[model samples]
Target chain A: MQVNGVEIEDTFAEAFRMVGSRILITACSRQWALQAATTMTGFATSVIGCGCEAGLEREVEPEETPDGRPGTSVLLFAMSKKSLADQLIKRIGQCVMTSPTSACYNFLESSETVLVGGKLRYFGDGYQISKLLGGRRFWRIPVMEGEFLIEESFGVQEAVGGGNFLILGQDLESTLRATERAVAEIGKVRGVITPFPGGIVRSGSKVSSKYKFLRASSNTPYCPTIRSLVDSQLSEAVNCVLEIVIDGLEKTEVGEAMRVGIRAACLPGIVRISAGNYGGALGQYHFYLRDILGGTLG
Target chain B: MDKVILRLKERSNIPVEAEAICPDLFLTKSQQEIEELALYYGNKGRRLGDFFQVQGERSDNIVIEGEIPNFKKIGQGMSRGNIHIQGDVGMHLGALMKGGRILVEGNVSDWLGAEMEGGSIRVKGNAGHLVGAAYRGSSRGMRGGEIIVEGDGGSEVGELMRRGLIVIGGRAGDFVGAFLIAGTIVVLGPVGLRPGAGMKRGTIVAFQEPDLLPTFHYNCLCQLSFLRIYLHHLREEDLNIPQEYLGGFYKRYNGDTLELGKGEILVWAGQVA
Candidate 1:
């Protein structure tokens, strides 16, 4: 498939299942709310090193929040249920609680299972108070700026992660340029997460086995496009392929992001592009690149 | 006071025990059942059906024509209902309601809204002491709910409240919100001496004047930006406050120094800081 004169490789992007939670952090102003949310979701790009994946889903107006204050909804994802609670407790207790005139609430799932505020209430010692309004429980912890109101708990549900597509280019600069455009376009996709730092991964990995403890290693098969007698997956003009993995609400959302990202990457100097999946062996969710960009999915 | 017309064609006032009457009860019940229930007055072991006359079965509302000064614990423990009393009622009105609303058209006795967990109560006239106060030996007061009084009230209003809100439009007697743990209470009229006497947490906003207790120390006077935000929020609600008070400054008093020092009394003193 050729999109805007760029060849679409007949490959598929792989994805796996993960748990996600959405939290709404509202403050006295939009700036303050953004400050608190940004701080809370900081250093949380990928589960590889950060133990979780978190991002600011959207900035909300006063009417959009439960307390009618300017707020931002942030989505936090983790590989396990325990880490989801662990990551939330640590970040919220540090970021939102420390921020002045700011508050946090449940933005996505509405239930009692995920304990965010309930865990942070310990900051108030025994003096911490709980108020149930219209059936939703809010913890009122006395802070320097009067009180901080946070929902007792957030709701958690199943989500998808590791959905990816690689953009192969001629050189390093060309690879970076095309990947940058793809990232910018794919960033507009909703209900999905790009957990990697800045939503772009430079060092893409391959499945296992240089060491006993190593689960995966770098992909060494597609190295360069130089004229040489070497076993490589690149043509004479092909040099590098940057990957854009997505984690969204559904497999279709991730597939849609791939379509937009690929369409945006079909520019000058970019050669044949493809995706790195487990060859139908690894991740449960499979988004065939050709099928997705060609507007078809099996 | 102007008489509030009560039609009782629907909903059974089946011995509605809380002190006041609210209209929401009539939405679901048949009128015949209410007339039979309103006459109920449970004393000692006697059933509440012994008090008033069973009138026409027309509306969920039951209007009492004469004074009902001896009724105690009216509309108690009601979950989804409304009651409208025409005359002065006895003590402990809306004692432990979980849901629904109660509106009293006349005066009421002591212990209004004591131990109320949920729902709302609005009294149009004067009430005796301990409105929204804790029961005899218990420390937990109204955990969640709202209480509004249009006229003067007796002492100990919101006495050991853990959560919920209480709004008094008229003067409140001494010791308002004595030991509030959490929640908010806004009084538009004069709050007599010793408000927030032993409060550990929660907020009290008096619109007129507050006779704060000596235990409450005057905190750093700053233009409370959050108050403007909170006031703006309240303004959007169906709150009954004058425009002058909404824009006024509140003397922020942080204490019940005697406790965890978490309680606050924001008196609307008509100044910016």
Candidate 2:
């Protein structure tokens, strides 16, 4: 199938089953809220190297937050429940607690939860005060600036990660433009996050590598410079490629994000849209490119 | 058909022990059985039918219509359902209640909701002393629940409360929140002397300047995020909290140094930051 002159590859994007959580970081002002959210999601591009994948979901209005302050919501995903819990404690404790006039709260509601503030309360050094309001417990730890408040637990649930699509173009600028458009469109999809830098990954990786120590290596088939040396998947007209990876709280949301992203990436100079997979093995979720593009865009 | 109402037959000056008037106990009994339930009228074993007229039963919703200032233990140890009182009620109104709601349209005497583990009690008029407090020798009072009084409250409110929320929308008498272990007491009007006197760990919020014990020391003048959240929650609960109070700074006083020194009393400082 083709969409706006761009060929749609008959393949699927393989996504692994993971655990995810959403947290709200509120501060005295919008600037501080964004700063804390940005800092908490830093260096969290991929689970392979970063131990988790995280990104800012959206900016929340003061009226929508628990503390009636400007805030932002962030989504984090990890391969295991234990890893997700550990990452929450480390990132929230080090990044959010240290930010000025900041407070963190669990935005998601699930039966299963991980103790975040319950463990971070130790930072109070025997001075933390707990408040139970309307069945929810919050801890207030005195800080140099005043006090930092956080919810005692955060909800975590099964999620999908590595929902991605690749944009192949005739040139570098056109490919980057298409990739950016795709990212901008994907941002409108709730419960999903594009974890890579600028929401675009220039160096996509393959599962196998020549080095024994490396679990993944660069996608040599899509590399333009060594097109003649490797078994290239790209046509002679295609010169550059960029990938947009998505992690979402649900499989349907991930598929919806991929559908919008692929449709938005089918702009001028873009040659084809393809996805990465391991011969229909490995991951539990698979987003078929043609199947997703066949549906109507919301 | 909406309720199991009990209308008083006559005005009684003698105290009545009506512990069997709980919604949990009446949920499965017939109207005749509910009237047949026992009660103690001034130390004499009596029938509930001898004092009140019972209507509609086998439900968890109860309504009492009378000014029984001598009726005690009305909803004692109830776990679920609702009880709506339309007149003045005596002491131990909801003592040791675990779950459900008790809404009073008139005044309540002392020991209201004492030692309640869970549930909520809302009074539209004044409440006597020891509201949500521990019994004479119990270690903890009001382990979990909420008590919202829209009118004046007597002395020693929320004393020894371990975990819960007590909101007094009007003026509070002396020794409010004394010996609080872990809970919150919010008095939206002027409070009496020695608030949070011997609190080990708790919070007491006074809208007007309060006379505190000498052991409490001035801490800081700053914004409290938790207070904003709590006030917002109270607003949702239909409490008439001002918008400025939800976004204002408070005078934090670290007190009860005679005890743990972790307790704090936050007096509203208007809109100043």
Candidate 3:
């Protein structure tokens, strides 16, 4: 399938099941809220290395937050339930708790949810207080700056991870331009994030080989600069390639981003576009590039 | 269960606790059976049937009428019933209640909602001391319930409260949040001295200026994010909250400094940051 003049690969992007959570951080001001969110979500690009993948979901008005302050909503994902809990406790304790004039709350509330405050309340030694208002329980831990309140727990949902598509162009400048526009478009569309650094990944990896100990290595097939040294898959015209890794609360949002983003990204300095897949579905919802980019191809 | 029609006959001075006589307990009991419930009045025990006539036959709700100036423990330890008092009620109106609701149309006596664990009690008139709180020697009070007073309130409101929320629309007396371990007390009226004293952790929000003690430490000036969300919760009642209180500024003080320095007293100084 060809979108405009760019070709669309028929392969699919395989995503795996992941545990997800949304955290709402409220601060005295928007700057402080964003500051804490940025720090908490830092170094969290991939669970394979950082134990979790997190990003800002959106900026919330004071009317929408608990405690009635300017806030930001953030999403987090992990491969395991325990890891997800651990990540939240450690990151929130070190980041949100340390940020001045900030309080954390679970974005979703429900029964049978993992208790974030129930676990972190220990930080208060024996002085922690649990306040239940309007059927919702919140923990108030005495901190140096008055008290830090956090919801007892947040809701967990089965999410999709590893949603992606490569942005290929004739040059690095062109590819970056398309990536910049696409990043801005998908930043806050609800339930989705491009977790890569600056929302772009330059060195994509593949299953291991050259080193017996390494299970996965760089994607030499798409390495246009090292085409001669590696078994490159560049179509001669494709000079630079960058990958965008997306994680969504639902598989359909991921599919929607791929549909809209692929169409917009295939416009100027681009050639053929493809995605990464783990072959079989392995109990995940898969999105085919051709199926979404079908009209453009025609 | 036809409410809005059942009216209590006015002018009974019998001090009766109504929380126990909730809907679940009355749905099966006949009017005579329900009226037989015992109540303590003026150092004597009286049945509910003699003080007030049971009007509704098919509902669990009971409407009490007349100037019941000596009513006591009206809804004590009630789990699943609603009591509507049309006249003034005496002390202990809703002590140790676990569930259900009690709405009093007139002023309430002392010790309203003392040591309640669950349920909601909204009094449209003034309430006496220790609303949504525990008395002396009690470590916990009002574990999970809500009390909304439309008019003024007496001292020790939410005193020694371990959990729950209390919103007072009128003036409040001293020690508003004294010894509060965990809970929220929002007073739209003027707060008396030493608010939140000895509180380990809790929130004391006053619409007017608060008299802070020496034991409280000045933390910093900043806006609280959770206040917006808290106001949003108040909006669930379809009530309009003042923007200055919801999205305004305040001085954040971390104190009861004599205790753990974890409790906070957010004083609204007419500033946002």
Instruction: Using TM-score, give the best candidate's number.
Output: 2
User: Candidate 3 at residue A33, lDDT?
Assistant: 98
Candidate RMSDs in Å, in order, are 5.6, 1.6, 4.3
TM-scores of all models? 0.79, 0.98, 0.83
Candidate 1 residue-wise lDDT, B175-255, digit = tens: 998888877777778989899988998888877667667788886543343344345545554556565564455677888
lDDT of 3 by residue, A167-253 (tens): 888999999888777777777468888888888899888866688888888898899978888777787888999888889888778
lDDT of 2 by residue, A1-298 (tens): 9999899998899999999999999999999999999999999999989999999999999999988999999999999989999999999999999999999999999999999999999999999989998889999999999999999999999999999999999999999999999999999999999999989999999988999999999999999889999999999999999999999999989999999999999999999999988877799888888888777321
lDDT of 2 by residue, B1-273 (tens): 568999999978999999999998999999999999999999899999999999998998999998988999999999999999999999999999999999999999999999999999999999999999999988998899999999999999999999999999999999998999989999998899889989988999998998778999999898999999999889888999999998888999987999998889999998976
TM-score-best of 1 and 3? 3
Better of 1 and 2 by DockQ: 2
CAPRI band for model 1: incorrect
Instruction: Please state the Cα-based DockQ of model 1 relative to the true two-chain complex.
Output: 0.18
Report, for all candidates in order, the number of backbone clashes: 40, 0, 30
Using DockQ as the measure, the top candidate is 2
Lowest lDDT 10-residue stretch of candidate 1 chain A: A223-232
True lDDT of residue A68, candidate 2 = 94
